[model samples]
Target: MPSADLLLTDTHIRTLDPAQPEVTALAVAGGRIVAVGDTDDLVRDWQGPGTERIDLAGAHVLPGLVDSHSHPVWGLEMATGVDLSGVVDLDGLRGALRTADRLGGWVVGWGLDHNAFEGRPIHRELIEDVLGGAPAFLRLYDGHSALVSGAALDAARITGPRSFDQRAEVVCDGEGRPTGYLVEHAAMDLVYEVAPRASDQDRRAGLVELLSTMAATGLTGAHVMDGSGLDLLAAVEEGADLPLRLTVSPWCMPGVDRAGLDELVALQKLGGRRWRVGGVKFFMDGTVEGGTAWLEHADCHGQGTDAFWPDPAAYSEAVRHLHAAGVRTATHAIGDAAVRHALDTIEALGESGRGAHRIEHIESVPDDTIPRFAALGVAASMQPPHTAYTKGDHSDEWSKRLGDARAARAWRTRDLRDAGAVLALGSDWPIAHYDARKVLAMARVPEGAAGPAQGLTGLEALEGVTSHAAIAAGQAAEGGRIAVGLRADLTVLGLDPVTAPADEVAEAPVVLTVTDGRITHRGA
Candidate 1:
């Protein structure tokens, strides 16, 4: 028998395997687990003169975590921009812009929440004054709306009202003049087209930094749900050795034709050990806070729009086409109506036979709609940390728009689990913090924050980020477990999360992270 390349011993390992749930030691070779057994026994039999044996000193180990839905590229780009998540009022907003202006170049900021402004109307004049005539664009926390300075508006050549297929509106003053606020991607893209883009080098550096951070936070894999697959591929080709495995999902926007579908299908040909274009992403509706999600009815007399595809039948047909082509689909569906539409489309497809389809951000679902997820074998990709942005007292914009009853049903993770749905949790990074520990912590105590009675048990929450997450990404066969022959991706924590107190679980440090038999992160 070949000697193992590395041996990890003297640890408490939770394999998440029913047959052998716990083990003290494991051996890795050629990027895969070769054996797992008693520490002394494995060391005696598998350890070699050349083997690298690391004593874990009783640290707890589990399968390396998988974030079922995230936007790593977007997160990195946001990092380069001014972070307005901490700004509270108009003064704070102005201060943030001023600081960003000092950084030089075009001023761009994200994570501005209008709810924090105490109902102060955002206008072009206000932003123009802050930057002193500099070109600036500030995106709301939801990523569904943005405010631009007058210079930015001019740069984009937006002087009048514009229409979009996706219900986006360039807010207009009574005189039909464009306000600074832009809603949804269609409107936001106008400014982005003129905004200075991060250079390839900048993106490469940012991605490397982001991956290292993810490894430290206990993530060995992520399902990247955005249009940056090509960028990731380029980064890898440029000799950036990413620490985590990535399954990229290229964005498949509404109105895509057969040729577009074929283009997306071709992306599947690009696959390597570290990355693969595993699926296509679609936005069924916009965010609730943006007043664009396809709610059951108008929220407080605000008529939410139709699906992004404009024609519901066309959206369903697109899903059918993709499903027929053996491509997995993950639709961003926040409102109950949007979630139902996605679920209905998947159900109508009647089993793609390739992999499980997914619904991203089922933020609001009717009770009856919960069971359909399991019934249709759709994975529920959710982010518990997103609830942190809300007050839970019905004062936040989302809750106020959703009203008391619907708000109570936000992110029904437990209910979905109860209905036998596969729960795959993530941070949706750039929207929320990407730490797996924080996600686990939030899932375990989501009551009041996300919604009453929405919390999961500690074990269940852990599974959401591990086994279930892997299942969602279609990697359960080769990863997500500590069985022999599975990829040697593991996260060593300071304590056993299952048996530890909630605080301990939340605060437990990642002592080490191993992916493909290689130690990606190690801490004393």
Candidate 2:
């Protein structure tokens, strides 16, 4: 009955729309879904004159995957910086650093997981040996930590460890000497404080290139988990001219003083229609591997507990302020203490909770808190690679630090789901490279690298990465499903995800990604 602008048919459609369940065809009109049914019904009732129809040829079709969290610039910049993610050992690292050139500037390298390092601690002298006075900076794998030289520190005007540090701490040793390692939020700011800020043109270019990169990987929508900079996103917009669907979650920085949060919230409001203000990001703890991630137990050097609630009253009061003002709160809480702290703060905000405050990571949460997340309706926004990455030899320390009981609680998505918590999965890119499909692989692949027994199923994982992720982003109404009346944001895959091999599911090529009724990306 509805005249449609286009008809997409002959695909096994997992509508993710429970009402009609599965459909063999999809109909679109004016860039909005018109109907979905058998090919005959879609063509007969919805297809209009001059309708552009696509024959999917029995491939898989669904709403485009929405990546819940990632630092887009950080990952791509690594392409231009030192990429040590692939290094196997000290020798390999030395070899990579030796080959990395600064094009007449300081050499900055990203993508090293502390777990990826061998026996030796990351030392200042060691960095000096490799980089000498070249003014170099190396970011930890989580993008939450870094190791920099005195030259680089001086260039940034960091007279002491405190200068390079912000919300995160800079590591120092006995006698008040600085160490090369800066943890969590500390590491991220070090680059921004000292490293050259990208020009508007450079940022624009980076965004364009990065958006194109995400499209190739089949991500139709993504959340900018880091802070905001219009200049930086220009590059993404240039590449994705169709208006990429992005949500910007700004970080809470201290320098702003009393009105800082308020002013920044207003600034973030300029994301326009295409980008929504998802939430405000506050770090409750730190990244798990970095040892800054607040844990119940002591860290390696006994810097007290790595994780703490961070002035619970203040944290609670802040949430109340945000909740009262209509901005959602999304905090970084990797270890149990952090998660517990985040939950407590959210709980303190009372029923005025207008937004879906989420706990990013929730990696090493306590068993009892599982129900708390669901009870409070807080989403457990998670990344899968933590499980996969830890399954190998890198897991030993985490196992020892967490012990068996706690470690078993590591990244319990299934438990979270069963306990009634919303589970939203993402790659946490730059930290992990598994694509839209790869994040799903975490749900279906074996856990802790032991085998299939630990893995989740394709549907379970896909829901977390897709529907649930969209829900967490507050775009659940239109972003996660394929159906009539829904926005025409979909990803056409070469293989059917429901029945495809786990490996192939992740590797499956995206035939096309449609946004707003126009084909933004199509495979050659």
**For model 1, the run of ten residues with the poorest summed lDDT:** 229-238
Model 1 RMSD vs true structure:
1.7
The lowest-lDDT stretch of 10 consecutive residues in candidate 2 is: 303-312
Clash count for each candidate, listed in order shown:
0, 9
lDDT of 1 by residue, 120-164 (tens): 566877767768778888888887889888888998999999976
lDDT of 2 by residue, 126-216 (tens): 6577674687778777676788777776776665557432346666777556676776665546555767556667767767667767776
Cα TM-score per model: 0.96, 0.91
Q: Give the per-residue Cα lDDT of candidate 2 at 173.
A: 77
